[model samples]
Target: MNDFKSLKPISVYSTKQAVDDGYLIQVDQKISQEAGIRYPVYLTRAVWDKYVEVPEGMEGHQDQSGRLWDVLFMFAFFGRKETSSHLLFKLRVHLPNTDNWEHNEKVAERSNRLLREVTLKALVTAQDFDDPSPAIFIMKPFED
Candidate 1:
């Protein structure tokens, strides 16, 4: 008979483990590319869930790419847990590596409408997995 007391418990997740699991690699790569950075390069997600203070109405919607995450976009949020609710979308874009705020701002204006009030920032750091094996981080919306 299957005994509930003998059932194996599931393990929890850690950030560093996530780093090894290739969690945001695809999103990082694409974002880096759009931001004009090279791929396979390692950096950390800035204003991340662990660090950034999500506004009262904002939340994070992580992308779950499974084995095909390369085509997904990492979107952010700032609000309640309803599909139709009005909130905010967060997208942190990296500015040119060099000090070029003017061009960066201009780019934002042309590319993303969310840049107006949704809030945005550009920073360095998205940890690239050192391991060669491709892994995945199960992503989902940050629900309260």
Candidate 2:
């Protein structure tokens, strides 16, 4: 077995930086061409179990691709485990449609709650891997 203790902790690379590096255009383009509204979310396999879990309400109802994850699972899991693999998650998010202040406020409130409720570590992927390797964890906002 690989010595889990010896592998380097993953690194966190911002999505903006990835775009600036010109390494994410192909995936971004594919996202745009296939689904107009869905954005991308990613996480490595080493940390996947931490951030995702089946809630009681949606036990067996969720389809494989459409399953729901604990909102803070990623943050909580990665904060504890250390590994060298760079796993990527191609998930999507659907923000509220209406621009009403109250709705937006609620959204911001929830985001803050998650941030406050969970402590996120500065996690990132290793750089020596080949092109198109998975990142540690990142969620790109929906682009119209």
Candidate 3:
């Protein structure tokens, strides 16, 4: 049996293990390239900053081979209302090749940026809000 109140669970997350989720590559079409130098598709990105705080030691990172792209932080924000929910997410960035690395930083930056950006949907007006919408919100307060 489980407790109804006064219950909490442990949580752990890391940008270094991001590849394990497989969403990074699967979600972004721009990264669907075999050759690192090639990205036939265009990348997307968030229009504005989206995050509360990046925590203390959970910002950007660099790997042994120097291939890095920190999580920045994932934000679930709404463009229509305070209680809206969806795939819309934001992430900050700092790729090792962001400007003058072995790889084309533009490409890396573009693809990484794309992963945070959605497929680009039409915005909803205040009038378009559906009350009784249950007031949606997002926070990855759980683990797989």
Mark the regions of model 3 whose C-alpha exceeds 4 Å error after superposition.
1-73, 76-82, 98-144
43-91 in candidate 1: lDDT tens per residue? 2243232223233333443332221222122322222232432232343
Q: Candidate 1 at 11: error in angstroms?
A: 20
Candidate 2, 1-144: lDDT as tens digits? 788879875876655565566443223324322433132434333122222333334446543233223333343344345454332222222322334222112232454422212222332443224435433343321211
How would you order the candidates by TM-score, starting with the best?
2, 1, 3
Tell me the spans in candidate 1 whose CA falls farther than 4 Å from its real position: 1-16, 20-26, 41-46, 50-54, 58-144
C-alpha lDDT score of every prediction, in listed order: 0.33, 0.34, 0.26
Clashes per model (N, Cα, C within 3 A):
12, 11, 1
lDDT of 3 by residue, 1-144 (tens): 877666654653432233355322212323222223121211111211211223234355423111111221122122324343343433333422222222111232454632222222221222112333222122222211
- lDDT ranking from best to worst? 2, 1, 3
Candidate 1 has what TM-score?
A: 0.22
Clashes of 3: 1
lDDT of 1 at 44: 29
Model with the higher TM-score, candidate 2 or 3? 2
